[model samples]
Target: MEIIRWQDDNIVLLNGAEKRPMGKCEAQAVSTLLVIKERMGEDSQLTLLGCAVGATAAFTGFHRATVSRHGPDVLQRPEKQKTMKEMGKKERARHIASKLTMPQRAFLVKEIHNIWADKKYVRVESLWEWAKANISYKYKKTYFFWTLKGLGFVFRKLNNMTVVEERPDIAKLRVAYLKKKKDMDESNAFYGAFDETWVHDGMAPTSGWQHANTTMYKKARMVDIESAQSGPAKGKQRGKRGIVLAILTEDGVLPGSEEILVDDDDENNQKADYHGVMDSNKFKEYMSRCIPEFSRLAASKGRPGVFIIDNAPYHNATREKPPTQTSKKADIQQWLKNNGVSYEAKAKKPELMGTLKNFLTRNGGRQAFTVYEFDEWADEVEGVKILRLPPYHCYWNPIEFLWAQMKATIRGMGSVTDSLPIVRDRALDTLRKFSPSQAAALFRHTRQSEDDVRGMLEERESVEEDTSFELLYEVDEEGVMRNVHISDDDSSEYVDFSDISDFDSTQ
Candidate 1:
């Protein structure tokens, strides 16, 4: 085989493989040239080979093609390539570890713990902000996230509540409430959940497929009889607002429950029968009316009734009137006495209503004193017991979900105007259409949630259950006890309707 030096294109026929020795080619006669490159370094492995006849020009095409195809791989010895591929992961890990100092690592871990402790969202900026303040440098969010993921962190959102507004023992009672409520051993056991919601005029706002160019459901609903005859497209501005108080049961909305027509604009609006929004007095009145009707419904079914309501602030008939620091001791004691509240009264002290005047002579009026005249009154109602869903846990009440269905059904109807009351009429009409079985499905979900919640408590899964608040990502870092600090900027606005002219339909 003829071996030629590639750089100068000098030819030599090697008897075997070429070693270290070399010579110059001055007067050359090339027969069949094999252009081969020399190995320069101990590890250098690149080689060039070609077959050509006679002149340098004759071998150029073949030489170029051979080097172009395999030059780089040939130059970069495969053994060393394999060595890099093996150690690359470990080298990267070491580099990342080096980026975090001992103090920083501790701080990050603490911050993560603090975030989870408060059930707060941990943003990348918060971590970077912390890193900048304590770690002396901020890592890119991607890298920081990867590092966190390696440390067993995950992104999440709050789907339930876990607050301590109410006592844990009190909240746990809900499981028992759910257990007996859904299934009763007594033949004719009645269950019901009551709540109120406001409805607005116009088409219900919803997110759905619409032509890209078209507006959303902000358009009006047609209600006039002649206009309805013409077609659905002909319409006018609608009144989409009203308040409704509904009571739902496993069997569906209770019989005594009827839609009360609320006049959205004027409480005294003669056109509407029900006035304004639901208030404390109205709720009291509604409850009074409902008790007997509830009794009647139970009688019809030959069952005892249990009614559930939310513990809205309005539902509070009586609240604790503890003496404050600024209150006069005598006055606090006298007020409790005059209200006939039960408190620790000394035997020597005469009970004015039911408290000892000397009791205020101590630190303060008895803190244990409670006033629950409303609860007593509710208890007196025959054939029914009133229960409140655990604070922040409206999901415990299936009626809430039923209301969603009620609203969604209202939306499915074509445009609605003041001519047809969606809240008082159409909404109730849709609710009436719901079968007892269909409504029971929603109730079953609530029953299942009871078991799920009970399971969580048994497993010691969470300190609190999903009430209503959104849960975000949780971190497992330990030691740090500081949670995310939030500062809110609030502002209010109002529009002056007096300045606007009335609608001129004739124009």
Candidate 2:
């Protein structure tokens, strides 16, 4: 075969004949012609071998007759062409390796070739799995398979590789964000509102508690008409009772300015017909007295802050409605504004309620302390902005912290049968054990420290188990695994419980 150099030829050759020149020729066609000639033998004539010749002539330069009469037999040099074909695979492998990064190339070398040259770890599925996990791109797997085919790598059916791994950078970024937030909270003051909720656990005291208490025990009933007619003994029922003092504090710290009071919730109101803490007149009296007092306590001397409370029926209970048929929220707001205190009803949101629940739930419904020591609680505490913890996170409040300590101390102690003074004194003794200064110091020193932040992030970063193609298989009488498919289209269904229950069992 004549091994002619590649060039843009304007003429096409048929089996053994040359055709007239056709204008400008394509360079790729010229090269392909030279390649075909080198693949053919030396004395081969040009033209007439049918479709390939016609294609060659059509692509490069030629007339139809030359290609039809004399084929592409002129371009066959089978021996040398085989040599070129052999070089193609190795060259392609080199180009692919060159395209990869050092780490990726090394991974491929170690994983695919086992670099030791032993072929011990040269697993196609393992390589595919590694690629699927690490090489994240829309066309990565397709390109990878093409390259693998070009390399002559044995690619048996892999275990259906589909599990995509999370990038480490995402975890690193998340941890950084959490750390930043924790840092921001370190110097800032958090504030919240407070409220109380009572629940029944079933217990009742008879004679000694109070005349009012005894009356409540005798008077309160589920069936109103029957209990009213039946008399005291018939009305009494047995059940335990408990209360939750919810204080939503800012950043889980109790405000040193305010004190939480737990009192005997009066059950023996003269106007027991109304479904509330007090009757109309008593409700009005309560608002007129307590609202001003609480506002005075909650607001500052110079810039009195607004207080947020829920729009509960108890708060809006009024003796009369205006001609405009105005609601109680307006009345309360008016009173608060008149007294130099502003008020707003909190938005009904679960997140706010969650913060409150965090505090109240932890304290087991009891947060006892006296306002008498408010000065001592607030004294000399620098970097301590004593704002009310928002209305629900009482568990985080240090006052509740103190209360927790007290509750733990007296968990199994006999119930308080003594007067309110004795109970108050005992509570004071509990407070004395946990000094506010010491608690505040502890919080300042360890406030959402780096270690805590990391732990929180790690908990959040906890790996999600990969179950992308988890399959279930069962055999029929013919003994073939049946009805297999991919699992869990929704990412949230990924549970790490990791039981083999996901697989089919032969009965």
Candidate 3:
């Protein structure tokens, strides 16, 4: 190939001695050369167009270095290399998109749109599925999601909802209180810890079928006196029947005040495969035995604190049902009238108590007390105060922490086959082994995370939005968007929103 120029200003290439114009296919080629020369500078002209020999070589594709060496040219350019790199990227994206099918194109567009539309932005994969079902399957699920993300669609989550931080002051205070109480020193502080746990009829043995069976039988038999006495003797039983007792105490080692248990293993309990009996007499018997401990705990060190408990029928012999029906709250009111414990004002929102009740019912009734032999147990624990958690506010009671810890520890342990007594024993033993510090540690781990707390606050703030701006917009008979920009003097348009809804002024 050869190239010739008219006075070196205009140049042309010749293949095998045939001259060609710098036009058509060769025009764009020559233009590129000129651009490169302008980029490299006038000094580079010789290697690019020194003579027919060099021109021919340049036309045939010589490296810029070779051209620069012969021509010695430098261009006044800021970032020629960077522009070329960006061009490559654009070309790559175009090439990939061109390979996709028409259905994929539509799906990608719709998925991006759907994610943008959701109040809580949808994830790319999830968004792609919606787009795919509604559009076409030309795109792969994973690819489509990433493709959209690459284009800048964002999937957002409430980042501030978790509790990232805690009030260290409160934690420090709790530690100080515990220490003071342990030392048995008097301080103005009302230092105390409260907790509640269900006592199963009995706990299952760690090993052996015989031991486990015995434990189950022991738990199944933790019923109150009425249920134990009314039923006919089983296999000619001779001694007084044992009673199952559920007591809520202060310290695990101390006896509690309020106590109740199954009177008998009725048909309901049997059907449910639970052999617990509800005996009011047995319940009363257990309560009497624990009464002194309760009194002692309440009057501990000559300082008295009111014991709080829920309004359970067994607590103070109140009406079983609420007063809204034929059964009046008065029935219960009368019992509390003489009882030492005073009922606080009923909770405004009882739903809060759901967590505690659900925990109780789900774990089999508090039958562990039966296996513990409460009367004998109470005789051993000198003084303990019993306090029932006020209804709908189980969260206030520290015992909620105990259950929370237990649930987390036994999250996936398989089903229980032995019996209630065995379950109770195992659970109680586990509880007994756990120190207050260990219990507190478990509570810390199980509670919600920091981000969760912040998100809730943000969510609460969002729900309470200002509506004053709503009056700025108005719709009329014409199907066109309009603004109601009324001034203070425009009383005609100042109708109350409620009244405006009720009117038909057009009629």
Each candidate's lDDT (Cα)? Answer: 0.53, 0.37, 0.39
> What is candidate 3's TM-score against the reference?
0.29
| Candidate 3 all-Cα RMSD | 23.7
Put down candidate 1 lDDT per residue, 251-293, tens digits, no spaces: 7787657566455564233233233466678777887777677
Q: Which candidate ranks first by TM-score, i.e. highest?
A: 1
Stretches of candidate 2 exceeding 4 Å from the true structure: 1-181, 184-395, 410-416, 436-438, 441-455, 458-507
What's the true lDDT of residue 178 in model 3? Answer: 31
What lDDT tens digits, residue by residue, belong to model 3 across residues 1-507? 234343355445543345545558777777776676666666665664544445544555765445434432221123442221243543323333443344454455555444544535556567656655765444565445434433333345554321212333333333332333323323221113333344333222223224334544455567533332222222211111222232233444233322223334432334232224433454456556655655565466455332323333344443232222233455444433433324445622232233323433443332211122332433355343233332333443444555555433432231334344444444545455556465444323222221232233444457664232222222233322233232323223222222222322221
- Count steric clashes of candidate 1: 13
Residue 264 local lDDT, model 1 = 50
For model 1, where is the 10-residue window of minimal lDDT? 486-495
Tell me the TM-score of model 2: 0.24
The Cα RMSD in angstroms, rounded to one decimal, for candidate 1 relative to the true structure is 19.2
Tell me the number of clashing residue pairs for each predicted model. 13, 48, 58
